[model samples]
Target: MKHLVILGAGTSGTMMVNHLIGKLPKKEWKITIVDQYKTHYYQPGFLFLPFDIYTTQQVKKDGRKFIPKEANYIQKKIELILPKENLVKLEGGEELPYDILIVATGTNIAPDEIEGMDGPGWYKDIFDFYTYQGAKALRNKLREWEGGKLVVHITEMPIKCPIAPLEFVFLADSYFKNKGMRDSVDITFVTPLSGAFTKPKATKALHYLLEEKNITEITDFNIERVDYENKKIVDYADTEVEYDLLVTVPTNMGDALLERSEMGDELNHIPTNKATLQTLDHENIFAIGDATNLPTSKAGSVAHFEAEILTENILHYIKGEPLKEEFDGHANCFIETGNGKALLIDFNYTHEPVEGTFPFPGVGPLQLLKESRANHMGKMAFKWVYWNMLLKGTHIPFVSANMSTKGKHFEKMES
Candidate 1:
């Protein structure tokens, strides 16, 4: 029997297993997924945890529960990957040989990368919401704390869910308003980007929203270090911003195991073909999700789209057929604004977000690049879809892996 080994039983790996189990012949191909974690987290829920929108119990589950019985699930920490030998070594004296390997080991936060970030103020005055424990900790801190200087920050770019810091500040605005302490708290959004977001049109829209909410926008601020004792963060240019409470998104990097194998980039992310989702070095090895150093957003929607393309390509590779390079960096994000309203943005590699209807050209239950109550409901309803349809490998209706321009209004770009 041919062995197919998948590392990291997270979102992408779990979806790949479920999608390929029935498609790939069980007798001929043995599917196995390996990871160190016993619990699976709905990472998107982490953003809501600080705001009390989601409880911790709703976000975690047994990792084995989502994995299919048809696939072998191994809960072990990976020590190294001997790609030349086509084997994965566990922490103990065990090795699993594979005919084909899939790398899905996701990204992690590196707060220690910044000096004084994890210093005296760590988990006390300085907090992060990117991790499960961090988000829960911030919730506790927010509960007992009175309002003060709340600085929401991003250490660097290319973080998972890039707009989450903005969302955090927006939700914080609403949270404090409801608590009747909106005037007592001052929120500031700090980022390394030149604008509120990466794309031009989305940035314009988001910048307006930030101004409307009276949340100060501090752009192009490259952080040098956190001055914990002084209750301030300093940039490389000697600029400083003090905070009574700091909720920061730390620098994100791919799994360290990739660096150990010398198969990844400086950030430990695997070099993969952007469209094909296959590793650049080895033909039989593929990468997906936050593990790949693709120029696309490191988001769940991007991973979901990549998995669909990768599944088809894997079958093509086994049959010795040509693999399709059809992935267009398709990504869709729901931006939560305040007051029971949210906004949606859908775009790809060459397109920026525009005001239009989604899925349907003329009429939409969800609007693109515009705030609406419908969009908020769609955002809330996605939690259900994520747990039920998405992880189970069930195809989402009306949503395809590719981007569509049917309803989007694009302005003519000058050469």
Candidate 2:
């Protein structure tokens, strides 16, 4: 039987298993997925865990639960990817050969990339909500804390869920206000970018929210090191931002397996065809989600969309057909602005997020670029959708893999 091996059992890999299991002929092929962890985290929920909005139990579950019984699941650390030999070496030195390989081994926080960031202050005064441990620790810290300078920071660009740091401060604003300590906590958002976000329109809208929430913004601050001794962060320009509590999203890089194989870019992200989801170096290998160096948001929504497109391309490859250049960098994200409000942004490679109705043109139960209680409800409801529909590879109704621009008000580009 032909073997198809998938690296990583996270959102993207799990969805691919679900999507292709029914499509690929079972009599001729077998599928196997590998990962080191037993628990699968609802990463987006990590954003809410610190403020007591979501409990530790609510954010994680058995990784095996979502994976189908028919597909082989291996719980072990990946040692290396021998792409030339079409073999994967596990930690115990066992090798698995494959006819096709799909890489969904996503990116992770690299706090050690910055000096002193992961030293004495880590998990004491410095914390990151990107992991379950960090989120839970920050929760414990926030519970008893009287509050002081709370700095929400981003180390660099292309981090997973670029909007999450902003969301953290917004929730911190609401969290403190609810506790009657809004006046006691001082929140500052520090980023290496020139603005609150990468896109101009979204940045303008988010910048307004930062001002409205009275959260300070320190832009273009490229961090050099963390002065754990002085309780401050220093940038390359010698600028310093002091803080009592520092919650940072450190530099995100892909799995070390890519680095071991020498098949990845500087950040360890595989160079992939942005449109076809195929790895540039190998025709039989494919990549999706945060594993690829795609110029798009590294969010779950983008993974969901890419999974759909990649599935089609994989099928074409099996039949010795030309792969479809269909994926357009589509991404949908809900920006939680706290106080029971959020803003939804939908865009693709050629489009910036504009004010538009989603799913249905000019007729949305959800509004784009506008904060409302309804959007917040939609954001909350997504957790249920993620567990039930998204990972299962069930296509969301009314939402296509490609972005729709019919109802959007786009500004005219200067030709």
Candidate 3:
């Protein structure tokens, strides 16, 4: 019997397990999943944590609860992945050999990477709402925050759900207004990017939103270090901004096991064929979710799209056929603009976000690049879809693996 070993029973790993369990012949391939963690976090729920919209208990479940009974699930930490030897080393000194290896190790916050970031003011004056624990802590701190200079920061790039910082700002505005401290609080967005977002058109739209919301932006501000005792963030240019409270998105990197194996890139992300989700060095090895160095956003939607394409590729590889380069870097994400409304953006590798209607061209249940109650509901409704449909490998009816350019309003290009 052939052995298929999967690492990290997170969203992508769990989905792949469900996908293969029912698809592959049980007598030919036996699947085994390994993860150190017991509880799985509803990561998107972290965005709502500061607002008291989601509790700690609501966002957590045993990781084993999601794993299918058809496969062998092991709760253990990975010490190293020996791709050349086709084996994964467990911290307990046991090795699991595999015919096909799928790495879904995912990314994690590395606050200690930044100087003074995890120092004196770690979770007190400076709090990160990225993790379940961090978000819950922020909720407690926000409850008594009397309003001062609130710094919304991004230490570096390639964080999971890139738009989360902006969403945090929008929600914070609404949060303070509800507390009657809108005027008393000064909100400043600090980022390394020269504009509001990755794309220029989206930046224009976002810059307007910032002005409209009276939120200030400090562009190209590459944060060099956090002065914990002084309550300030200093950039390389000697520029500094002090904050009464710093809500920051810290550095995100892949697992330490990647470093030990020497199978990862500079940042510890696996070198993968972006479209195929296959490892560069090994044909039988594949990577998914935040673990891969794909140009697309490290998001759940990206994982969903990648998984669909990867499933096809894996089946092809097993049959000794040419793997399909089908993944188009398709990603869709919602930006919470507050007041019970959110903006949706959809695009692929060659295309950036443009004005458009989604799902349906003329009459969308969810609009694109524009804020609406319907889109907001779509954002909220995804929580249900994530737990029920997405992770279960059930196909989403309205959403396809590829991006749709129909109903999108594109600006005329100039030569």
Ranking by TM-score, best first? Answer: 2, 1, 3
lDDT-sorted candidate list, best first: 2, 1, 3
Give candidate 1 regions above 4 Å deviation: 411-415
Q: What is the lDDT of residue 318 in candidate 3?
A: 88
lDDT of 1 by residue, 1-415 (tens): 9999999988899889988988998789999999999999999999999889999998888989889998999999999999899999998878999988999999999999999999989999999998999999999999988989999999987899887888899999999999999999999999999999988899999999999999999999999999998999999999999999999998999999999999999889999999899899999899999999998899888899988999999999999999999999899999999888999998777777778998888788789989999998888988888888888888889888998888879663332
Residue 188 displacement (Å), model 2: 0.5
lDDT of model number 1: 0.91
TM-score of each: 0.98, 0.99, 0.98
Instruction: Report model 2's TM-score to 2 decimal places.
Output: 0.99
TM-score of candidate 1 relative to the true fold: 0.98
**Candidate 3 C-alpha lDDT tens digits along 229-298:** 8899999999999999999999998988899999888888999998888999999999999999988899
Model 3, which residues run further than 4 Å from truth? 411-415
Task: Name the top lDDT candidate.
Answer: 2
The local distance difference test score of each candidate is: 0.91, 0.94, 0.90
- Per-residue lDDT tens digits for candidate 2, residues 326-356, read 9998999999999999999988888888898
Give the lowest summed-lDDT range of ten residues in model 2: 406-415
